[model samples]
Target: MITVRCFAQIREILGCDTRELLPAHTPQCAADLLKVIAGARTADLPKPLLVAINCEHASLTSPVKDGDEVAFFPPVSGG
Candidate 1:
């Protein structure tokens, strides 16, 4: 199982800080996992968000390995 963490508005929306997913196959990259999660939670999420893997910012295609921690958050705004 891989660990997925949610932060900021994402955490509030999901109502949980973390989640576990069992990928059918080893995800080639972070993008792959995002697709899975997005599809799974489509009903709950309607907007785009940012994702990080292992505390590092990553693109959708970023590779993901077993036991990696993935975090999701909304875009930041500043005045």
Candidate 2:
């Protein structure tokens, strides 16, 4: 199983802060994880979404395995 956490606008969009998915329900990459979490709303997700694995920044294609913690959020901007 994997733990998925959504923050900021992402959490609002998905209507949940965290979820747990079995490996069979999700593929092996961060991209696939996003698809599973977003489902049909995938297209409505923010463009250029940021991803992280176990607290380290990662790309959409980053490999994921059981027990990994994945986080998704929109890019942040501050002055």
Candidate 3:
């Protein structure tokens, strides 16, 4: 089971922090998974989401395996 975690804007819109036991198909990559969570709407995904897999920074194309932890969050900026 894949673990999906949403943060910040993504979390607020989805109204959840984590989703568990995702099927090991369809969305085989981090970006595709986020698109699925965003209801397949490109606009909903916005841009430049910070993603991590198994606690390490990863690209949108990173493959996800069963039991892998996938996390998503918007970019952060400080002045």
Which predicted model would earn the best lDDT? 2
Give candidate 1 regions above 4 Å deviation. Answer: 26-28, 35-47, 77-79
**Model 2 root mean square deviation, Cα atoms:** 2.0
- Candidate 3 has its poorest 10 consecutive residues by lDDT at 37-46
**Which is the winner by lDDT between candidate 1 and candidate 2?**
2
Tens digit per residue, CA lDDT, model 1, 1-79? 7898877876776677877987556436765665566566645753676778888878666777878898877776769
Tell me the deviation in Å of residue 68 in model 3: 0.4
Candidate with the larger TM-score of 1 and 3: 3
Candidate 2 C-alpha lDDT tens digits along 18-40 = 99988864449998889889999
lDDT per model, in order? Answer: 0.72, 0.90, 0.80
lDDT of 3 by residue, 1-79 (tens): 7889988887887777998856655648887777767764547655787899999989889988888999988886669
**Worst lDDT window (10 residues) for model 2?**
21-30
lDDT-better candidate, 1 vs 3: 3
Error of 1 at 27 (Å): 3.2
After superposition, which runs of candidate 3 have C-alpha atoms over 4 Å from their true positions?
Answer: 25-27, 77-79
Q: State which candidate, 2 or 3, has the greater TM-score.
A: 2
Clashing pairs counted in every model: 4, 0, 0
RMSD of each: 2.9, 2.0, 2.4
TM-score of each: 0.68, 0.89, 0.79
